[model samples]
Target: MEAVVERFLKYIKCDTKSDEETGVTPSTPGQMEFAKKLAEELKNIGMSNVSLDENGYVMAEVPSNTDKNVPVIGFIAHMDTAPDMSGKNVNPKIVENYDGNDIVLNKDQNIVLKVKDFPEIKECVGKTIITTDGTTLLGADDKAGVAEIITAVDYLIKNPSIEHGTVKIAFTPDEEIGCGADHFDVEKFNADFAYTIDGGSVGELECENFNAAGAVVSIKGRNVHPGSAKDKMINSMLIANEFIFMLPDTETPSHTEGYEGFYHITSLKGDVEETKIHYIIRDFDKQKFEERKYIMSAIVQSLNKKYGEDTVSVEIKDQYYNMKEKIQPVKHIVDTAFRAMEECEVVPKVVPIRGGTDGARLSYMGLPTPNLFTGGYNFHGRYEFIPTFAMEKAVDVILKIIELYTKA
Candidate 1:
C-alpha cells in the first residue's frame, strides 16, 4: 500500500460532499472537518506557514532550499466531492493485477465495470485499480490530486538534497459547486503560477476550458378549474417543453464532444402555475459561448411573445471563462509541465477541457494556472475509478515538475 493510496482511502471516508443550496463557504460541515485533517497532515509533513481559513481553505508552503532564484509555484486541489452522488462510507475495492475483464463492483447489486461500456479501462489491464462498491462515489475526482501533491511534498521534504524553490499548496472547498476560487487569498498564497491537479486520466494537460454560464428559466401560467381549463388555463410545463424543443436537439451534452459546446438542461421543475428550468451553457469559443447565451434569451423572448409578457423570465449568470486568454501570455508554464511529463516517460495528451476546473477561474484571478491530471476516470459518479500505477506516475510527474523548475 503506497502512501498516496493510503491517504486517498483515508480522505474519502470523511464524506466532504458539497451543496450549492447551502449558500455557505464550505456548504457542508464535512468539508471543514476534512480541511482540519488536511491542515494537520500538512503540519505533520513539515510544511511551513500552514493555515486553515474560516472558509475551509488550507494553505501551506515548502520553503525554497537552493540559492538560485526560482519562481514560487502553487499546486491546488478541491476538497469537496460533487453533489451528484453519495460520498459517505465510500467502500473502495482494489483489483490487484487486473486481467482486463469486467469487474464486478457489487455482486448483490449486479453492478459491474464493463470494458465494453468504458474501453479506457482496457488501458489498465495489468495494473492495480481502485473503484467504488457501486453504492457511493469514490472521491478520486480531486482527492487523488490532493494525495499526489502531499506525497510529492513529503518526498521533497525527506530528500533535502533535491533543492527546489518555494512551493505553495492549497485545498479548496466547493469547487464542485463553482465557488472554489471565491475566497482564495491569491496574494497570500503568492505563487507566480499554479497548476490545478484536478483533471481526469493520465497525461492530460489542459490550458483551455469552456466559457461557462448558468441560466434559469422561470415560467408562470394561469390555472383554472378543470371544466374551464380549455383556453382559460395555460400549462407552464408545456411552455417549458416548447422552450426545450427550441434549442437544437443535436447540441447537447450527449450529442456534443471535443471542443463542441452544448446547452445542458440540468433540472426542470414546475406544474401549471409556475415552473423553473435550470440550464448550464458551455462553449470553448468566446463568440460561440455568447451565442449560446443569446440563444437561450432569444427562446425566452420568443416564448414571451406567444405566451404573453412576464410569463417567461430567464436569468443567466456568467460562471467562468476560458483560461486560454490568460494562460497564452505565460505559455512556458504549460511547456514546463509538458516537458516534465515527457521526462517522466508519460505521453503528453494536450486537450481542451470540456468542463471547467478551479484553474479556469484562478487564471483570470492572476494565477495563470493550467490543469494537470490525477489519473482518475469517470469522475463524480459511482463508476469512478483510478489506476494505482497512474497515481504513482502522477506523483512522479509532480516531483518532476518541481525539479524542472529548480533546474531553470
Candidate 2:
C-alpha cells in the first residue's frame, strides 16, 4: 500500500499532459519521458521482456511460476493526463483521516471541495485522501491505475510462492486525446484477455461505453462594412449559434445520465467571417449513435440550403464503440473481476462508462478488454481526488483477479 502511494505521488510529478493538435504518436514530449521512466522502473522491479516502443508504449511480462495452463492476463493503464486541465506542477495535498466536511484545497484561491457538490467525498471519512491544490489536476484519472498495476506485479515478484500464470502489463500514452490505441501492438502483447484499470470510483466494473464520433462544423460567412451592410453581410458566429440551437437543448451532457447519450460541443472558435465548431457525438446504441451523427449533418445541410450552396460544411469521424459488443461473448472475464472484488471485501458496482477508455478501443481490436476501478472521482479537473484506502483496495483486487485466474 505504501508503495502504491509513493509511486502515484512520484508519477504525477512528470506532467505528461497529452495534446490533440500535435499530430504525433505521443502528442507531447512529456509522455515519452514518462514512458522511459516507467520502462526503467519495470526492469528494476524484475519484470521480464521490458520494452518501451517509439510510440511511447511500455510493456513487460511476469513469467509463470506454475506448470498449470492458465490464460495469460494483461493489466493496462495510460501514461498521460487529460489536456483539459493543467498537469504541470501538480501540487498534491494529503488529508489524513478526513472528517466528511468541505476540503479547502487552496485558501488563497478560495478553492474548496464542497461536500454538497461532491457527496462522494463523505465516503472517505476516517480515511486518508489526496487532492490537488486548486491550480492543477491531480492526475489520478489513470495514474492511480498505473500505480496499482505496478505495485501488484511487484508484489507477485517478491512473493514467488504465490503461484500464478504469465501476466502482461502495458502503459500507453495519449489516452486523453483518443489515440491511446492508435499504435498499440495487441498481437505483440500476446494476451488472451486484458483489463483496463481506468474506471472511476472504487467498485466500478464496466464493459459498456458510448459509441463515439467527432464532428467539425465549418461555417463560411461574408463580412461587409457595417455602414454598407444591408443583406450583404452573413455573420458566421450567428450562424454557428443557429447550428447549436438546431440540436435538442436537453440532449446534452449536463442534462443526461446513465445509458442516455448526448451531443457535446467541445470547442468553438471564429468570427464573423468564419467559425469552426467542434462537437463529439456519443450514444450507447449503435443506431442512435448513427442518428446523432446524421442529425448533425442534417443541420449543416439545412443551414447550407438557407444560406446558399457550400456555405456550411461538416466533417465527422467515428471514434471508439461500446465494448459490451465485444465483451458479451467473453462474459466470464467480467464475472471473474466481480468475484475478485467480492473476495477482497469490496462491493462491485457494474456500471456503464459515461466516457470511453483505452479498453473500449482495445476490445474492438480483438482483445475483449474490460474496465476495472481506480478509486478516482471528478477527473480532469481541480476537484479530482482519491482515497488511499481505495487505491490499496484496487491493488488487492488486481492481485485477487490474477489469483482466481491461476486457480481456475
- Which structure among the candidates has the greatest lDDT? 2
lDDT of each: 0.94, 0.96
lDDT (Cα, tens digit) per residue for candidate 2, span 124-196? 9999999999999999988999999999999999999999999999999999989999999999999999999
Q: What range of 10 consecutive residues in model 1 has the weakest lDDT sum? A: 1-10
TM-score of 1: 0.99
Off by over 4 Å in 2: none
Q: Show model 1 residue runs off by greater than 4 Å.
A: none
Q: After superposition, how far is residue 318 of candidate 2 from its true place, in Å?
A: 0.6
Global Cα lDDT for candidate 2: 0.96
315-387 in candidate 1: lDDT tens per residue?
9999999999999999999999999999999999999999999999999999999999999999988899999
Q: In every candidate, how many clashes are there?
A: 0, 0
List the pairs of residues colliding in candidate 1: none
Top of the candidates by TM-score: 2
Error of 1 at 380 (Å): 1.1
